[model samples]
Target: MSAERQLTVLSREWCHLCHDLIEALKPLQAEFGFGLQVVDVDADEALEARWNELVPVLLEGEVEICHHFLDEGAVRAHFQRIG
Candidate 1:
């Protein structure tokens, strides 16, 4: 298959929800063949301001799939649509 598509997670240190979301997405990444990128929002002022409250935001090429929690259904739908 082609190189996996990039999926982004906007998160910060000490965020359990962010960690949970990543853990949940690991299996989906394997099934759908996408790569995960974790960004520490606190590291960037703009990113921190924009996503501080929405720290576990899941994005597929800038289109948000879900936030704060792992919306598995929405993620699956996004992958299927891209496919």
Candidate 2:
């Protein structure tokens, strides 16, 4: 993976789904060697307002890869595309 490629998880500390998604990404992150960042939407009022309903959103830069769950296929495809 290129150092420039990163995946961001918009998460909430209290959300089980958010935790699940982050855990799910760990193996993929190790395999793909992409940077992972987890952000709490609740930390920012604007972020919370915009993504209140989508706590476990996955993003590559500003582009959303998936929401509410981890899509491993989409993530793999993204890596392939970038390569």
What tens digits encode model 1's per-residue C-alpha lDDT throughout 1-83? 23468999998789999999999998888887787899999899998888778888999777999999999999888877877
Candidate 1 lDDT: 0.87
Best by lDDT: 2
Give lDDT per model, in order. 0.87, 0.89
User: Backbone clashes in each candidate structure, one number apiece?
Assistant: 0, 0
Candidate 2 ranges with C-alpha deviation above 4 Å = none
Candidate 2 lDDT score at position 73: 95
lDDT of 2 at 71: 91
In model 1, the worst 10-residue window by lDDT is 1-10
Q: How far out, in Å, is residue 30 in model 2? A: 0.9
